[model samples]
Target: MHWFLAVERRLTRTALELAIIAMALVVALTFYQVVTRFVLGHPSAWSEVAARSAMIWMVFLGLAAAFRMGSMIAVDLLVDLSPPAMRRIVHMIVGVASLVFLAILIWYGTAMALRVRSQNLAGMSITIAWVYAALPAGSALALFGVIARMMEVWREPAGAHDDELKNVEGSV
Candidate 1:
């Protein structure tokens, strides 16, 4: 469990760093597009496509961090209301559900990415598969993160769980 969390923490940390870079790329590309379109009176088609692609990468890469921090859209009310013993059960159910959902995403997203491998982006020569690949890749990373969080939750002492408010603030 210790080694698993360590790996997961590193994975989530790297994902967050990459996500920040992707976000910066998106901002830079969008700024370039605006400048070329409005200021120079010449629209840049490739920059728009690049910006959109970067945004997608940014969102997907950030997903792992969100899941690791337990900041994903979670209904903690049920777990919070449950008795101490039941809380672990509730968490297990939620964890299993999340793993299942992410697994489905990985399967379908890989299929979709492969299906689009031969296609090109709207204004770029890059294969559309690169854009689609984010789905599966990000989901796999998020899956690991979810598992790590579940481990932490299960290891908590009875009645040691944080309240829903702490969860909302990503304190879990």
Candidate 2:
């Protein structure tokens, strides 16, 4: 579990960093596109396509960090109201559901990428598959994050979450 968690931590960190870079790229490209189109009176189709691609990659790559942080979809009120055992069960169900969703993403995302492998971006020479690849890659990283979070939760003492819950409540 320790080894798995260590690797997961690294994966999450890397995913987050890449996501940030992708976001920055998206912003820069979009800004350039705007300046070229509006100010220079010459639109850049390639920059627009590149910005969109970067945005897609940014969203997908950030997925692992969101899951690891427990900021993914949740019915927090229900979980907070449950007994410790019930809370664990709820967490398990949510974790399993998340894994299943990610598995589906990986399966279909890979297929989609393959289907479009021969197609190029509208204004770029690169295959569109490169853009779609983020789906499976990010989901794979998120798998590790979900498993690590589940493990961390299970390892906690039964009453340990009470204080944590209070802290969360206060923050919100």
Candidate 3:
């Protein structure tokens, strides 16, 4: 279990690093675009496409990174009020559902990417498939993160004490 957690942590860190790089690229590209449009009076032809692609990758990868950190959007107020047993049950159900949903997303996204592989982008000479590959790639990472979290929750014995939950409750 410790080994597994270590690996997951490494993966999360790597994803976060990639997300930061993508954000930097997007900002630099935007600055370049602005400079060309105003100073040179000649906007870059590929700037728009590049920015859009970077934004897509940034958003998707950032979402996965956030999910790994347990920072994704959630309505856990009710869960906070529930007993620990109930909270554990709810967490397990949610984890299973998330895994199933991600599996379906991977299947569909891969299929769509394959279908578009032979297609070309309108303005750029790049393959349309590359643009569409983000879906499955993000889904795959999210799926792994969810499974890791689920395993953590499941491996706990019933009635196990959660130190974090106790701290939150001031029950220490």
Q: Number of the top candidate by TM-score?
A: 2
Model 3, 2-84: lDDT tens digits are 78767766666666677788889999999998999999999888877787788777776765666554443462554566687
For model 3, the superposed segments whose C-alpha errors exceed 4 Å read 157-172
Compared with the true structure, model 3 gives a TM-score of 0.82
Index of the highest-lDDT prediction: 2
Q: If ranked by TM-score, best first, what sequence of candidates would result? A: 2, 1, 3
* Candidates, ranked, lDDT: 2, 1, 3
| Candidate number with the higher lDDT (2 or 3) | 2
- Deviation of model 2 at 48, angstroms: 0.9
Poorly placed runs, candidate 2 (over 4 Å): 162-172
Candidate 3 Cα lDDT to native: 0.70
State TM-scores per candidate.
Answer: 0.89, 0.91, 0.82
lDDT of each: 0.83, 0.85, 0.70
TM-score of 1: 0.89
